[model samples]
Target: MVIISTENYEKIVEFCSKFKGLTIHCERQLHKKFSDIDSQVLSAILSKEWQKHIKQRHHIILKSSRIYLQEYKAQARLKGDPFILLQIAIRENFSPVSLCRILLSVEFEGKPKSVTNEMIRNPHQIPDPLLAANVLNCLLNDKSDGPITDLKRQTIGEDYEIRLKKLASDAGLNFHDEVYLRRKGYDKTPDLKLAVPCMFRGKIINWIESKASFGDMASHQQYIKDQLLSYGNRFGSGIIIYWFGYLDQIGRCPENKDCIIVTDDFPKKDELVLINNPFGPLLSSNISNITNLL
Candidate 1:
């Protein structure tokens, strides 16, 4: 979830600039390369003669009495198919799936939680909290011949701890700060320390740890309150976020309940902060022109 550094950004730009014709690296493999992606995606990224290519293709199709590419694209969309569009973006090199996943992970507004490797092995069945955590962990801990990856342990148990620490640091949010894990006479200290500006003038605001679901809050309020009390605040806040990926549905922490649920949509109750999505509205508008933007 770390923000892309200028150095990394430059590297990516340089990589894109040098891309060969009609070729791309597949997302599932760092080393595998393929040439059969959407011509549009490839054209968008690597071809300087995209318009000429399109025009010549159109001319050939017209001479042969075949469907025009632009017309075909419109037809496919009208037929309720996103596969073509997705393929084009993926193939033509608009952006790699890895980069998109990285961007989403970077912008995520919730705390990183630990999930089992079994859950990661079968993400389709797990909860969002666990799934997201595992996905972020894998991305952050990906094995490349890089300085950070070289230092990480190979075993899942050791790697989990290492990855979690890295994930917290990447998120710019403390995950284990002031928290401790005690097992058989060994106590492991937290990696992250929650630091938010003091609220109510002088009182330092402590945060509560709880699940990211709206349903979990009503059931788990006492446990969260207890965590808050372990620190020093009767008025501590819990940062709540919805586990569902929907951009329109908002979640909330109860009013005056020493908590704050952060979501993209406004909460029905008080004591929540609504984070804005830069692409949500645009996507909605594109999907349906009737959606009111005003």
Candidate 2:
């Protein structure tokens, strides 16, 4: 069956005529009427047809929402953190152009511990809280994270120490990935640093720091802030820290306005505010859980 319907057909015509050099294809079936346009006129018109098809698909999947949720759920299984799935959901809605800007303004509140237990009970429910807060934050600022991945220079120990000490030296902040830092000399730290909003290269966030129980690290809270502040931008004022688990423990950083800790460790009934970012609010969560993730 033809995916584009008569209702949206005119819109297709307008788009094709507006943009030059476009192509359209249907995976399911061939369009007998498509041949009527001829090769020369077909380019722009077909492109618009493809655009319409994609838009229609985006709306349909988003409308169902379940498909989106399922996509995230599967992603969570791989990441081992369900909340990461929520993060992924947010990413899906972003347009090609606004992605980087969206990534910059995004900062996530860590999940509470109780949330893990809650997931065990009813994993099917949409993580509306995370989605709401993230969406709101995205709208207000425009930004978006996960495991530690890589590094440029310095040893793990030296790199991590530099990152930690550097962040401490600054207002206090750091963000590091696992393989990247651990390889040099740095140990796996649970608390990702948010010392500075901007990085050394003049990038906003520097590293994704993490800490675990086994490793020898500095003071728990103070150390965390030190690492975070160090990573803060040497230029601008936006320095943020994201703690994956335990909200009350981290409470507020030296600059609560700049720091955020998200954990699913809270009571299911607890009221947590979800902030809407530019992309959309709790949209990914709804879509992932309700449609794709299922």
Candidate 3:
């Protein structure tokens, strides 16, 4: 549950920036390079910093397509990472379905177009050949406008959310997770909303949010605008867990108003105040009726 301060966080981010463009396979190299940081923490920081670079690079790619296209194609040929090509294609003019069709055609040296074209939108099964996997992975991965990076990050985020829910459950906490709350028509729901609010460390905690990435300055501010503020207004004070750690300075952001406590992990049993008296199923049914502060 380490809470990194502002100054240390900036230094960590700066150190991690050197690893931009490094792929997932570079974990071992990163571990040797970043001896001072935990492997998991280093990975998260590198992910944030690399993503920033990728975003900026993508913008430049769009603006200077004539120059970047040649560079991208060369990189794609040198490395099996076709995402470079896929991303540029998407950024250029192709919608996802169109991109799939184009890549499958003989123009791109793909399998018979008819065979692969049917499965444009995956999860809606079509006769997809095993041969199509590489291209499909690139096309799907490029949907987020990056090359093979975000899919891994998305998986990590889901894994952390599962871990958070498990820890909360093991501690005898009862709550409706984000999916359940969403189905019930709640807007701006946090990862876990306690069925019954509990006092923890002298503050009432109504909800909890899990962030799989490090909380850098920009990302934290964006979350405040898109999520934290709404969660605060609707659900009252809650906790935000930046699993890798966040800028210490973000906690003091004026908009935060001390309502959100940032932490690196789920609170321990000792840190949390479990309700001695269980409210049971009726509590859930009761809370479901309230429009705010649930």
Candidate 4:
């Protein structure tokens, strides 16, 4: 975890509160006075504060909606903060991108936090609230258009689909692309679906979800709630391809009955390791088991 000095934390909160909606160049400020404070520390503090805000908002939502504690807790555990999910629960006709913009606009009261002409003039300066807000919003709402795209660029699984397609081709597996799955009356949809000829005597259709990050516990939990669990429930079985390895600190995948985690060492170009499934398999140039989830 990233650690921030108490003094710096207090300073940041105090400075930010003074101009609630103005975007201040926190990076430059830190560089000027708190030269020891790094990006990781700043990110952690911002994320923690954002999570606190979301939790507070969630309580407000529960009180207003009169939702039971048990139900709220269960839902929150699965789908992140209740306040964010509440928008979807009500069937609000807003896209993730629009919803992000709307939430930031309303939450920040349409004003930017403490940004100055000089900071704007300097391209290297990073705005604190704006950066924090964008990161928080992106974390909560995966479909939001945010800075993750810019930061990740082609590095964070942007070409995952292409790589998957190539691997499937090399394996000689018959699969479809960009398939969507939803129950007849439900609104939730899985990212991709594959027809595995070798599995279940050519009768099995497996749901596949692609994640581009080095899947840490937090990211995995979010993915489980946001995509994996729902897909597993609807489809019965699935595959999660974590291109940059599953769990940053460990090579193991979480034990799950319905899904298999595939991890790859991108830098070393080593063989892909399959985990959290019945079969302990190593995938090399022959990527056939990607279609056969045994």
* Best model per lDDT: 3
Q: Give one clash count per candidate, in the order shown.
A: 5, 102, 2, 8
lDDT computed for candidate 4: 0.43
* Residue 233 lDDT, candidate 3, scale 0-100: 78
lDDT of each: 0.32, 0.33, 0.64, 0.43
- Candidate 1: 10-residue stretch with minimal lDDT: 241-250
For each candidate, give its TM-score against the true structure.
0.22, 0.19, 0.67, 0.38
List candidate 3 segments past 4 Å from native: 5-8, 15-30, 67-148, 277-294
User: Which sections of candidate 1 miss by over 4 Å?
Assistant: 1-167, 178-192, 195-217, 220-235, 241-259, 262-294
RMSD of every candidate to native, in Å, equals 22.1, 25.0, 7.9, 15.6
Least accurate 10 contiguous residues by lDDT in model 3: 123-132
Tell me which of candidates 1 and 4 scores higher on TM-score.
4
Pairs of residues clashing in candidate 4: 21-112, 21-113, 22-112, 22-113, 22-114, 23-113, 23-114, 23-115
lDDT of 2 by residue, 1-294 (tens): 012233344443554434322122221112344553223223323432444444544554445455545554465456545244334434453221122122222221255544433332232332545433433332333211111111111233344445544544443233343444456565433333332232221223323443311111113355446554443332122222221122233333344234323222221211211112234343334433323211
On TM-score, the stronger of 1 and 2 is: 1
lDDT of 3 by residue, 1-294 (tens): 445566656665665555322334344566676577677776676656655755555454445544544565466567756355455544553333234444444333446654554445452343333324535655554423333344567788899999999998998788999889989998778999998776555667889999987787788889889999888878788899998877777777787875687777888877776545363433344343332454
Cα lDDT tens digits for candidate 1, 198-263: 221122223323222222233334433544333323323434322221112123334324344333
Q: Quote the positional error of residue 83 for candidate 3 in Å.
A: 12
Report the lDDT tens digits of candidate 4 across residue range 36-152.
655434433433343343444454443434233344346555755525433442233222333333333333453663332222223134344433333344334432123443345
